[model samples]
Target: MAASLLQSSSLSLLLVVLVAAASTARAQLQYGFYNTTCPGVEDLVRTELLAKFAADVTLPAGLLRLHFHDCFGAGCDATLLLKSHNGTAQRDADPNSTVRGYEAIEAVKATVEAACPLVVSCADIMAMAARDAVNFTQGPAYQVETGRRDGNVSRKEDALRFLPPADGNVTVLTHYFAVQNLTMKDMVVLSAAHTLGVAHCPSFSARLYNYTGAGDQDPSLDADYAKNLTAVCGGPSNVASVQPLDAVSPTTFDLGYYQSVATHRALLGSDAALLNDSLTAAYVQFMTNASSVDTFFADFAVSMINMGRIGVRTGTDGEIRATCQVYVD
Candidate 1:
């Protein structure tokens, strides 16, 4: 009884320590972190991104994906921006192969540097850019806390380990998010970002062909939708093709993804996995109503902020790189 009591006490103490650490980490960041050093930092980023978005309407989705990939790989650090030295960097990972908007970020960084050199971190720039991306795509406009420092390490292995697979089920995805201190709700909400992006054939080809390794499609995927995807993606040889994640409103950041999931027309198995869970399925059903847009937007804002806080380095922990792709020695 005494040993059991001691074990329980130890676990309780560990939980408290973890909670305190998380709180401290979040406290290190604040809205308007660059208010004094770079008063117009946010405006600069937005303006630069606007130019890129004007040129390419699809840029918002790419930037949003970049932000998500960065956060998942190493706690919202700008490690994903690093140029791989030996093809081992996080950005070189297979999962991040389609992650675009690097030029946009670099351009934004250059503009910020011209205004306030060495004041804003790339990590913070990415956080703000992601917020702007969502706003540009008609999603919710939310304030992101800044002051994140760039991490020095970037490994393909980290990306492989941290990023949940496109084919992940609820169990796999939940474990992936849980490892980052994110809840199942956060997983569902963040997955809604899919409403704005597209998936390469390679990302979801299994669902269209040989889902069970016997050349059959995924039963969870809508048959008609699978036929359409197969038409778009072609056979195994056509790995270069892509498909919209939310066919209804591919460019909008609305609840179309939830509607797709509710109908089992979601492009990715990971998306369909939401319906397999009671809580997430109910969330998806609730979100299918057009009125739930505000609720989803609000919840998504909170979840993004939460995701932005993962594994962040602050308060002299990491350096501010002049160029996001190159390390500051």
Candidate 2:
């Protein structure tokens, strides 16, 4: 009984420590962090993004993906925005090859700089832009905390090690999220971002052509959907071809991605793997119901806020870059 009590006590202490750490991380950022320094920072980013997005409706997905990729590499420090000095930056990684919106981010940064030069960090700009991206795409509008600083280092190897793969199974994906202090529920909710993006054929082509290297399609994929994808994608070599991750309502930020996952019509193997885990699977199933739309939106906003805190640099830890594409001298 004494040994059991000791073990339980240890576990409780560990939980407390974890909770404290998370609290500290969140405390380092503030909802109105730039109000004093860059009072209209969010408004500037949103305005620039809105103008760009009006010209191209797909801009939201690119900005959102860009933020996710940046956060995953060196903790939301905007490392993904840095240009590869010797072809070694995070943006050079295979997983990040499809990530877009660099120009948009730079454009927003320029606007912010014009008003409050050397005051706002590119990292915060990305976090805020992602929030606005969701709101612009008809998703929930949530407040994003700022005060993130840009990291000086960005390695392609870090991106390769950190970013979850398109073909990752539930086990692989869960580990990635856990390393970032995110829950499995966050994994499922964030996967709904797929609803707004278009994926290149190379991301999911293996499942269509060679499931196990035997020239077989993924049996778990819906047959009719697979047929349609096969027609759209042609073969694995057709890397240039692209398809909407959510066919039903590709432009809207809704529960359509969950519906696709629940029906085994998920575009990426990793998306389909959500059904293999009990916790994530339950969330996927729950989200498929139209009534659960509000719940999913709220959850997504919370998850995004949580994700924005990962490995964050603040309070003189990193520098605020003059241009997102290059480090400050």
Candidate 2's residue-wise lDDT over 1-329, tens digit each? 99999999999999999999976775498789988888877888888889998999998999999999998877999988888657788888888998999999998899888899998999999998899889998999999988888888888998999999888988899889999999888888898999898999999999999999999999999999999999999888998989999877888999999999899999999999999989889999999899999999999999999999988888778888779998322
**Measured by TM-score, how close is model 1 to the native structure?**
0.91
How many residue pairs clash in model 1?
A: 1
For residue 150, model 1's alpha carbon misses the true position, in angstroms, by 0.6
TM-score of each: 0.91, 0.91
Question: lDDT score, residue 18, model 2?
Answer: 99
lDDT of 1 by residue, 15-119 (tens): 999999986875578889889989988988998888888889899999999998999998888999998657889988999988998888888898888888898
The list of candidate 1 runs beyond 4 A from truth reads: 1-27, 327-329
Q: In order, what lDDT does every prediction score? A: 0.89, 0.90
* Model 2 ranges off by over 4 Å: 1-27, 327-329
